[model samples]
Target: MSILYLVKKNDELISHCKCEESLVGDPGQLDCPWCGCGWLFSCTKCRKAFTFAEAKEIDKTWEELAREDLLGYSGKEPELEDINSWIDCMQNMVSHIEAGKTYIYLDGCFIPADEENFEFEGWKSKHNFYKTPQVIALKDKDIIDEVLSNPQYWEENIIQEQ
Candidate 1:
């Protein structure tokens, strides 16, 4: 089914794509099948669009092309549940977003250790994409700053505090 992709324009409404060709989902923009109103995602690059499910599948396909990044010293490596838990606890997933990087786009490889050695950087991922969303590509810029500002949430769950 086709879905409508809308973006909030300074508290206004803007439709990216009509819900006719691409797929769409519910309100939050999460991938939910059988949603009342389908929601689609527009490519920040070609301005192409896709339904929630379709975008997800596309993500899956490009996952390999995605660079591997160490989300953090999640004690050692990153765990889906732990990361997801942090995202839930913080209510924002792209905490330490990098410019031109899509935290959601990249598939996290959990380390499961406790700390990064000299061999590891704080995080690791691909260089950059030739074509993608500019905003989504750029780090939330303040994501890491925001996380640092909020100690309770970051330490309590995300980082295995020493």
Candidate 2:
């Protein structure tokens, strides 16, 4: 799996990049990909690059604090519950990344990602392309459920609804 690098300014996500490993390259050498104004620094915990100056004021790196916030590390092996919570948090983060994109429904319906004008016309409107809708009308629910539950199915069956 690839590591993700994120740069935040005032608690808002500004830039992000995917790296194969920790970007422990020379500090002050790389530029922030998102803003292009700040210099990149390696995060000690995740080894990812970020450009934040507040980290120095606190005598702690921003990446270290971010990891502590996300992972909840107490210098011990995390319990199963903690791991599960972290996983859920990461999933929510990924979902936020896709929050503003147009999504296609299972019934070949198009839904814009605008919250202000959004409307739930019917039950079919609740499901998006990333999440499979329950087809209770089908007689063979078991087979459909198994197929939909598989990640490979979503990867292979991405429809381009116009």
Candidate 3:
């Protein structure tokens, strides 16, 4: 259910070198995440992509990685199927999407969120998980800003006890 999860940079979507859409769909999405500048991907919430310095290297594997994470497809070659299932799956997951965070929307043959807590018998066979936030908003502040301030907001928000 890879709904072309969005990424951002400096509070803006990484424009495609050509398309320039904040989010680029699959298959037809043949340009950069949004900006065709380099091979960095920004997490929309974090507005951060792989540093430009690593752009060239990431190009070799960025699509493959996104494919695997988004659709549970292998990096080498993938199969094309109706995107309806993906859409349905994403719809369900979106229901669980909290504020102050973004979702990755990872879906494969089956809905990633189908399993209990999106897990299968203590083992994750194929990954279709969205990296979402627990709270999209906090105290009137936008979750994006919170993540921009601290990518580890989730970790930091957690109360560590002895």
How far out, in Å, is residue 72 in model 3?
A: 16
* Ranked candidates (lDDT, high to low): 2, 3, 1
lDDT, each prediction: 0.25, 0.31, 0.29
TM-score of each: 0.17, 0.24, 0.23
Candidate 1 error regions (>4 Å):
1-91, 103-162
Query: What lDDT tens digits, residue by residue, belong to model 3 across residues 1-162?
Result: 232233221222323223232231232212221231122333322232321111011222334433443443223434434344444443443344333333332111112212233432111112212322112222333534554234253234333443
Q: Please name the candidate that would achieve the greatest lDDT relative to the true structure.
A: 2
lDDT of 2 by residue, 1-162 (tens): 233323222211211434332222212222211122112334334444332212111333433434454442245555666556645543333332232243222222222222232333221122223222222213344634344334444434443445
The Cα error of candidate 3 at residue 56, in Å, is 29
Q: What RMSD value applies to candidate 2?
A: 18.3
| lDDT: worst 10-residue window of model 3 | 51-60
